[model samples]
Target: MYIITVEYVIDPGHMLTFMDAVLENAETSLHKEQGCVQFDVSQSHDNPTQFFLYEQFVDEVAFQQHVESEHYLTFSQKVQPAVVSKSVRHWYSC
Candidate 1:
């Protein structure tokens, strides 16, 4: 399985708008993509500007395809101005 956690440091003022875009992307990925197993978004309890995304895919190829998808591209473009910084970590299950 391929799992990843993406962290987004967002500008506090744009939280709502950013969430809207990310949520749409998450829902679309989960419902429309056969390789997408899980796509979840969460806000930090202490810091509302920090967002976390937990995503699971069938494989690296599936993930690459997700990155190339139209919805994902739209989300990325829409949220760019709201984002302060972003980071991603890949996971391996034994």
Candidate 2:
């Protein structure tokens, strides 16, 4: 399995609104993408403006496909302006 984690630091004033958008995006991604095995989002308790997204795919190909998907593109475009900073990491399950 391919596991991906994304961390985001959002603008403080827009945190709640950004999370709402992310939640909707995650729902759409999990429902529309067959390659998506899991898609979860979490907020930091210590820093509410920080968010983490965990996603799992069947394999590299599945993940590549997801990156090329419309839903992913849409989500990116929608959240781009709201994000202050973001990082992504990829891992293969042992």
Candidate 3:
């Protein structure tokens, strides 16, 4: 199994807009992607401008396909201006 976590730091003023975009992306993945086992988004209480996303895919290939998907590209383009910083971590089960 594979797991990934992505965090984004956005300008405080754009938090709401970014969250909306994230919600749209999450909905699309949940309904449309077969390999997407889990897709979740969370907000940091300590830092309102920060957001966390957790994703689980059947394997690396599945995750790669997700990255190349039209929905992902659209989300990335839509949120680029609002995002100030981002980080992604990948992990695998033993």
lDDT of each: 0.93, 0.88, 0.91
TM-score to native of every candidate shown: 0.96, 0.92, 0.94
Q: Kindly report which residue stretches of model 1 are placed more than 4 angstroms away from their true locations once superposed.
A: none
Q: What is the lDDT of residue 63 in candidate 2?
A: 90
Question: What's model 1's lDDT at 59?
Answer: 93
- The per-residue C-alpha lDDT of model 2 at residue 84 equals 95
Q: Could you give candidate 2's per-residue lDDT for residues 1-94 as a string of tens digits?
A: 9999999999987776787788987898788888888999999999988899999999999899888888778778877888999999999999
The alpha-carbon deviation from the true structure for residue 31 of candidate 2, after best TM-score superposition, in angstroms, is 1.1
The 10-residue segment of model 1 with minimum total lDDT is: 85-94
The candidate with the higher TM-score, 1 or 2, is 1
Estimate candidate 3's RMSD in Å: 0.9
lDDT of 3 by residue, 55-83 (tens): 99889998998899999999999899999
Q: Which RMSD values do the candidates have, in order?
A: 0.7, 1.1, 0.9
lDDT of 1 by residue, 36-90 (tens): 9999999999998999999999998899999999999999999999999999999
Query: Over 4 Å off in model 3, which ranges?
Result: none
Quick one: ranking by TM-score, best first? 1, 3, 2
Candidate 2: where are CA atoms >4 Å away? Answer: none
Q: What's the lDDT for residue 40 in model 1?
A: 91
